[model samples]
Target: MRILLTNDDGIQAHGLRVLYKAFREAGHDVHCVAPVTEQSAVGHAVTIALPLRVKEFKENGFRGHGVYGTPVDCVKLALSALLYEKPDLVVSGINAGANVGVDLLYSGTVSAATEGAFMGFPALAISYDDFNHEGLTGEHGSYVANLVERLPLDNLPHKCVLNLNFPNRPVAECRELRICRHTSAMWEDWYDQRHDPRGRPYYWLTGVIPPEKVSADTDRALLTAGHVTLTPLRFDFTDYDLIQSLGGSLE
Candidate 1:
């Protein structure tokens, strides 16, 4: 299968490079178009007011185009201008951090795959639970590539995204992949206010979901339990039940 590979962790990220090699060795044609620098948590932002720049990167037999813009921008630019043909699949990440629950709302990693789905292609976003890259290896990428090679891409619903998250442990240690749902839980977020050299206050964002809030059968809980989690997501944002109730009342 032809694949468009991208990530929010920048083009030169180890996880992205590992995935590139894995896909190539698996015999799937892969193209990498990703951010020139880390663009994590930027969500689905696009460069509307500024001209985007693309630079080709080739090193140690790995090649990819790096975009000086958001992860979503790379996918849009690649499909609209770079590639000679549309890809069969758009895969993002092998991200350093997990994208689960509300993290998906603020994740550039998942947003990249979401952009690919918007273009009517089968898309996937892969992430690891560990942020510091502890215990990560090529086997994780190979495992995911093997799964992608077997997925029924042609039959996937339009505008659907398969969000895959692997546990921090090695592939051999993971309890098989489990299909799950994202939790509706919100993060207990807070801002850390501090002073700069000039005595100006700056706020740094930090948060976590309380353990009691995560339930079993959801992506977060399963991943914490050392299982790979796959959650199918759709772009349709309509609250149909609410819409139906207010349909004629507002009319």
Candidate 2:
């Protein structure tokens, strides 16, 4: 398959390099177009007003393009102008952190894959379940490469994007991949007030997931259990039932 790889973590992230190597070794043609800087939580944003810049992104012997904008912008440019030939699949990450539960609402990694799907391509948003990488390497990259190789891509729903999360455990220890649901959970949010050297106050947003609310079938729950989770996602955000419920009630 000809694959177009991208990430919110920028074109130079280790995860992208690992995925690039694994895919090449698996005999697939791959190209990358990603943010020049990390755009992690900037979900689905597009650069419309400001003129976007594009430059060559190269590191550790790999070559790709870097866009001075959001992850969605990179994929949009790739499908619309960057790649010489359209990719058969768009793989948006091996992101630094998992995009599960309500976190999906603010994930640029997921949004990149979503943009690909919206452009009518089969896509995947992949990530590691652990945020602390203390011991990750390219050695385990094949686990993801093989998953893509074995997936029934032709069987997926039209314009569907899959969100895949690998557990923090060793790749060899990774258990069966399971189809799962995003957790119906919310972050316990708080802002940390801090002072600068000049005595100015600044607040940094911080939050945590309430573990007790995590259910058995959610991607977060499965990832916590050492299973790789695959959640099929769609770009459509319509709440049809609610739309019907309020259709005739409003004046």
Residue 46, model 1: lDDT of: 91
- lDDT tens digits by residue: candidate 1, 1-251: 88999999999988898899999999989999999999998998999999999999988989899999999999999999999989999999889999999687899999999999999899999999988875679898899889997888999999999999999898999998899899887899999999999999999999898879999879999999999999999867789999888987999
* TM-score: model 2 vs. ground truth: 0.95
Instruction: State the lDDT of candidate 2 residue by residue for 1-251, as single tens digits.
Output: 99999999888888888899998999989898999999989997899999889999666668899999999999999999989898989998888888997666799999999899889888999988766654456755788788888888878888898999888878878888999889988889999999999999999999888899889889988898999899998657789999998987994
lDDT against the true structure, each candidate:
0.92, 0.87
Deviation in Å, model 2, residue 204 alpha carbon: 0.6
Q: Kindly give the stretch of ten consecutive residues in candidate 1 with the minimal lDDT sum.
A: 132-141
Highest-scoring model, TM-score? 1
